[model samples]
Target: MTRAQHPAGDPGEVARAFEEMPAVLWAFAGPQHRVVAANRAARASVGDREGIVGRPIREVVPEMAGQQIFEMIDEVYATGHPVSHADRRVLVDRDGDGHLEEDFYTYTFLPTRGPDGAVTGMVVHIVETTRWVRQRQAVEARADDSERRYREARDVVLGLQRSLLPAGVPLLPRLRIAARYVVAGADAAAGGDWFDSVVLPDDRVALLVGDVVGHGAEAAGVMGQLRAVALQALVSGAGVLDSLRRLDTLAGCLPAAVGATVCLVVVDPRTGDLEYASRAHPAPLLLGPGGSARFLDGAPTGPLGADGKPARRHHDRLGPGELVVLYSDGLIERPGQALSAGQAELARVATAVLSEPVAPGSTLPALTADRLGALLVERFAWAGYRDDVTVLVAERQPEPPEPPALRLPAIPASLAAVRVAMRAWLGALGVPALPAQAVQHTLGEAAANAVEHAYRAGDPGEFTVAAGLDERGVLRLTVTDRGRWRPAPDDPQDRGRGLMLMRALADRVEVAAGELGTAVTIEHRLQRPAQVSAGAAPPEPAAEAREVPFRIEAGADGPRVLRVSGPVDLATAGELERAVRAAGRGGLLPVTLDLAGVTLLSSGGVRLLHRLDAGADPAGLRLRAPRGGAVHQVLALTGLEHLVT
Candidate 1:
């Protein structure tokens, strides 16, 4: 029933019933703006019990008196119609702490007409809306299924992320196309990093590697926006520099540059020549035949969206048989070191990896991907640099078996014979002209890594090196062995420059190691090296999050749990916002993670517990071992955990 104007008759009882009404009600002098009466809700809303009568509305809500909020009220009062507002946040005007809440209300400040049709006072009604908002959010969540939401979201996210990549590889007559992008984070969920392979309108291929800067939705959002802007700019005719300048201007509004880096390369594909710019992207790994890898010097440009300076471009070229691999910094940059350290680590792996795929046309992508991916996982998995990684490989395709053969010896054991063999082979190809000695050194490294790592002593692995002319007529040399072998860890004390030294002799390096053993490959093209600036593009840091390391003290029973904001996948698990003290090495007590903030948890997330348990680090602390609430309940039914918190 309405709080005001009740049925007449039981006058005393009716008055009692009216006084107990729940809604806050008020009577005011329409023109004077003085309060005439208030029900319990209204009085309490203003922090009063019994003495709040006869005051102006301004006196009760002092803050509002100065704020422009009441301008609408004045406008309404001047007009003779009732007005209402819903779901509006208003500040309660009590002393001490000011609290804000959503409220709905209807009002009539027009002159109140009495029985004589005269003006006296206006009336107002108030209703709380906090519960309504909560209910709406709950309804939205219930309507969404996690699986469908994730699939739809991935399509959207990847589509947006793909724009940051080059449109496609340019058709250089000498080059064969092969490139791939691998997500660094665990399966099912990925981060803001991306790669690009564009066939520029100029016919020069423009390759880009960049990171939008963060892992979750916000990072994803910015990544999508930036990529869209880049494609629009480049595809429309904006030069690389103009695109960089415009991107920086827009970046000022970002939360922080925790997610921006773009390295772009424009190569004159027809001539096997190139010009490039890198913001913070990793230098491309140039692989050649004969098992050699080298980190080429590209003018490291600053990142995109960094300072407001236009980025400059650098230049270079590809010989037939040489390959260039561009990748996101996430491939090398980790939590505890500088870029050089990361670069060094990459070089070590590059040299060791250039083997086995022997066939550049079909098997190279898979072979290159495996070694590179393993390196990243081994180095960063638990090191906590939890960011996404992307790698792209580009190289000249080797020729079909129609090239003329050089006068060479049958597979021989002597180093001199190998040099004589290499010199004769390249001499016949008439490209990638290198000294006999250089060829021998590269060939020796390939043979040594294979003999030492791929073969099980005297087992005589079935691999052997071969030479040929690529379609562009560049020299390609490969060392193949028939036994399975992983990349050998370069011993620092040993003089083995490994692939790094071999890289200097050739333009591209490749290695394929699997059950088929290891193949060390290198390409030495006679194509002249074009001079290009190896400068970094300007810096485009991703939007970094503000992180304050805070510790929560727990009650004897542990703190009340709170859910996290994102899902927990194989890449991330058990960090349930709970902490436990460790007593000894491997001695840990199961701790409950409130999980109030957690939104998604995968089966692999459940499996992480087993991995963590098997390798329990006593000295290193891992928090929230056992997930709880719904997760705990689910695990309970499955008997996965008898007492997992």
Candidate 2:
């Protein structure tokens, strides 16, 4: 039943089936390529049905004249060969509106041969592909736009990341500090990473490295805010745990900083004492002078905005010539590698780089902190990183040579000798000129007190002066005498002035008296400016004394105003005292000292003011200094702010 009902070999039925097919079919006869037959689809494609048959191909579809379709049909008829095209574009007025529209087709022109094997006609087959082609083009356009947006966001985030980082690490006397930051690979977006070094008020160096959880501008902004908060806390002398607590609180307020991590280390370079705290950050690696390295993982806590877990401060000490390395997790994180393995590799690489022998004739005594940081970053990130990487190195410098002790006879001449010795010692210690002069003058007073009161009249005795800088950079000067101690008389004018002067000049002063005589101990924390390098030679003393620029101007019939525009330290304080005395004219005239222009108001300068104030009436001598100026600050610290007008 199936075979008989199929009508498989019926000529009329086969022709009907071919004409009803979905593909467009047609035939052209002779060299003119005159169309002889066309199916329903082919006739409809040209916007004609009855008029499309029994006509030349160009006449049937006038728009095909310049499209070479007729030439292909003629070639197939003449050569008995076939031509085919895939996705061929054709412009046709399919709706008969006199406007051509684009269309794509996969079509073939096959030669139809006669019984003699000579080509008699050509048959064409076509399939429209316009819908598929348009769909693909639309998808590609969306992809291109998305890629462009991604790149723009990445660029913006990278710029923010760089601007948020510190421009340079602080240069310190006891600590050599350096930092480096590296971005991720080119294909990856910029991640949030930052590093900073701040020299605290106590001369301790604070090093920090941190990472935020995500990428792009949000991550960068969160990183910048966190860094700012941490820096502010540290500069305010907040302890390690306290600073991290502040950072954690801020991170809790920021959704982007939820998983942020940071490691902070504050180190007293003079004592090699380091205290550190971390919030789910990697432990710092410490490299010793003996070529050994280990991670400081003593104190650890959950990441920022994590479950409540109290942060703790860890205590560790670095030896002279040793280094403490702080870095972001990127430095010790690699794909398919364990976190512990990455950290171990970091320690190994840091040790190798830092332990390498210094080049011959190198100006540095050993590997510098800057060079060490660079090497560590290069070694870990040479193959490229998927996240941002940062490294910070802090190295403790070697101890400076101690100054010699001084022993002099208890006489008036000994005071001068004590001043000379102390000046030389303080200069060798790289103390600034003003502070050095303050120390020298303070010691001179202590020595003069010993010479006058430590012994009975005409009893020869020797006094000893010893000075040493402790591990905390405190200069301790001890003036000892072997004679018996004599109690101060009841009168307040003569006996207690030297002791009061000593307390005012030094940061702390203590007088120990017993049968063994007296020992006056003075302690002052030596402050070194960041610009001065460790072990740098003291600058040559000025051969000629710098002249203080002094000019007296009458203040609108008020008083003679003496403007002093130079440092008022030990070397120049006597000259200033003399000028003030001359201006006073034996306490007969009123004088005002305008200290607004004074660059430095050392303790010697303060003493000169005290003496002048004691001799003249309080109304006769007045001081004028700008509020918040250096002179005003010093006077406030010395309890002499009342003198300023």
Candidate 3:
């Protein structure tokens, strides 16, 4: 391996080695920055092979090429020292498109050494640097996008949470309700916090506040389900305690299992008397006169989460203008310490608010939530829980109901008496051009049916005939009975005729039927003679059927559902069945007739109930209530107890 035979001895062979190297190598002679030699890679990087072989370095890549070329060459040739840039942007055709674009690279040059230690030629190297620059930019863009999506999901959930809170509390005589809801942060979360007020079948006002276990969207979803379940419980004439216990069970066991914490507060507005039950939730603060605050105690259970705990309730009452603050855990968990101090601070804040002109009766919820929310952050500071904050508050303001959403004249027993009452009530209403005579006749027919058919003789049930005008000036009459009798064939002696006449006169008739009972509704509108003259034959109507899927049980709060399998019925035929009655425990839940279950109704059944509802008690024969069809038809037609509430 002598240097001569190694090919290293030939200058031409050494030059060929440089061209074969992978590096983008180049060289310059003397002091001029001219390309004396350029390899294949340098040609490929600039998209020019032969075109750049003899080109000046500055002419091929104008940006930074001229200045850098001169500086490096001078530094190498004059200083006799090597200088290099590890990563620098240079203009080069990246895709071989002949268009030079900025790319990154490393470049270096060393002073040429002659055989006697004098400079002769310089060497240069280039390595493209675009890959690293583009990769870094992509990472930053992805990080920013993730942040934006997170914020959007959070804002949406918070907005929905606020809308679900109770509309401003209604001002009622001897009843004041202060309500509030607090959302902890602007992120996706479950909101099981809620407040509500309802008028019971007994004319009592029921108020409730509570939280569903867990926090965030899933928790909020379960909370909504439980809230609806609780409302249905209270509406069905459930006693406060019974409703609480039953709902506790249902909230933990729906189609999909979930758990909840709830409270029930039923108040008799007239007497300022109140009753309450607390499930697995906080004990409410009852604000007495002069800002005296007391926590009403109740039996507690574990909050409803994936697993449910037994629910317990507390009981109490308040005078007119008394304030009750019901809330979730966000307020108490403000600091990492025990909540006893939080409770005391809440009481102090309450006292301060009561001393001011702020109406604690109506404004307690807002004031309490705002103050409690702030106090929690201030006192807890960095010690706050990572969970979302939820706050709900309510107070009672003693005031009369603004106006009745719907009211009826007390129902009287005899058909003739009902006729008289209807006329008197209508006269007082100043209805013009009303067919009073036709109305009385229709009223009589309905009353008679209610009295005779809605109940089996001696069943002790009664029907009610209520007539009213809707906001649209349409006459709406409802015939409700308690009989759950299943429909039987039309009586051979008397076919259905009462409903026929009533339908001929009314513009629309809706029959809502179910297993429990049936509701027959008839509506009439005052029409213009000109419009009536156009080929407008009166519409002939008959019973239309619907379905009931849900199963319900009576609770102290209202209708405690054991299970609801069917869609809720709101039609006239289903009204009777929907009008659930919870006669003290151990009472019979009859196999009532509801039209939502029927494909059709017999004329005889319609007539019979029409007469009974009109207040007519048939000849002294005791109507042995049939358990199904025929009995249901009789009750629905006669306005029997089975059909009436």
- Give all candidate RMSDs, comma-separated: 25.4, 28.8, 28.4
Candidate 1, position 382, lDDT: 26
Worst 10 residues of 3 by lDDT: 528-537
Candidate lDDT values, in order: 0.50, 0.70, 0.51
Task: Estimate, for each residue in 536-628, the C-alpha lDDT of model 1 and write its tens digit.
Answer: 111111111221122233434533322233344322343432233222223344433333333323333344444444444432323332232
Best by lDDT: 2
Higher-ranked by lDDT: 1 or 3: 3
- Positional deviation of 289 in candidate 2, in angstroms? 14
List ranges where model 3 is wrong by over 4 Å: 1-154, 162-168, 254-259, 305-313, 357-645
At residue 472, candidate 2 shows an lDDT of: 48
Candidate 2 lDDT over 1-645, as tens digits, reads 454466576667778988899999988887777888888888778776357777787777765543445545665776676878776656566676655556678888898878998888888999998888668655533344347567546565444555677755543456666666767654455567877887787878788888899887778788889989989998898988888889889877988888888888888887888889888899999988787889986857899888767688889898998888888887778677798888877776666555444333222212366556655554454334667778777778796656658888887655555655665655445565556655765676677667767888788998999988764467889999998766534333434545665676689999898888899999876653221111111122211123234334444434467777766654567778777777778677878888766755655567677777778887877888766444675677666778777
Candidate achieving higher lDDT, 1 or 2: 2
User: Which rank order by lDDT, best down to worst?
Assistant: 2, 3, 1
TM-score of 3: 0.36
Error of 3 at 261 (Å): 2.1
Best by TM-score: 2
Each model's TM-score, in the order given? 0.35, 0.41, 0.36
Q: Model 2 off-target regions past 4 Å?
A: 1-258, 264-393, 409-445, 455-462, 472-474, 484-491, 494-508, 525-579, 592-611, 614-618, 624-640
Would you give me the overall lDDT of model 2? 0.70
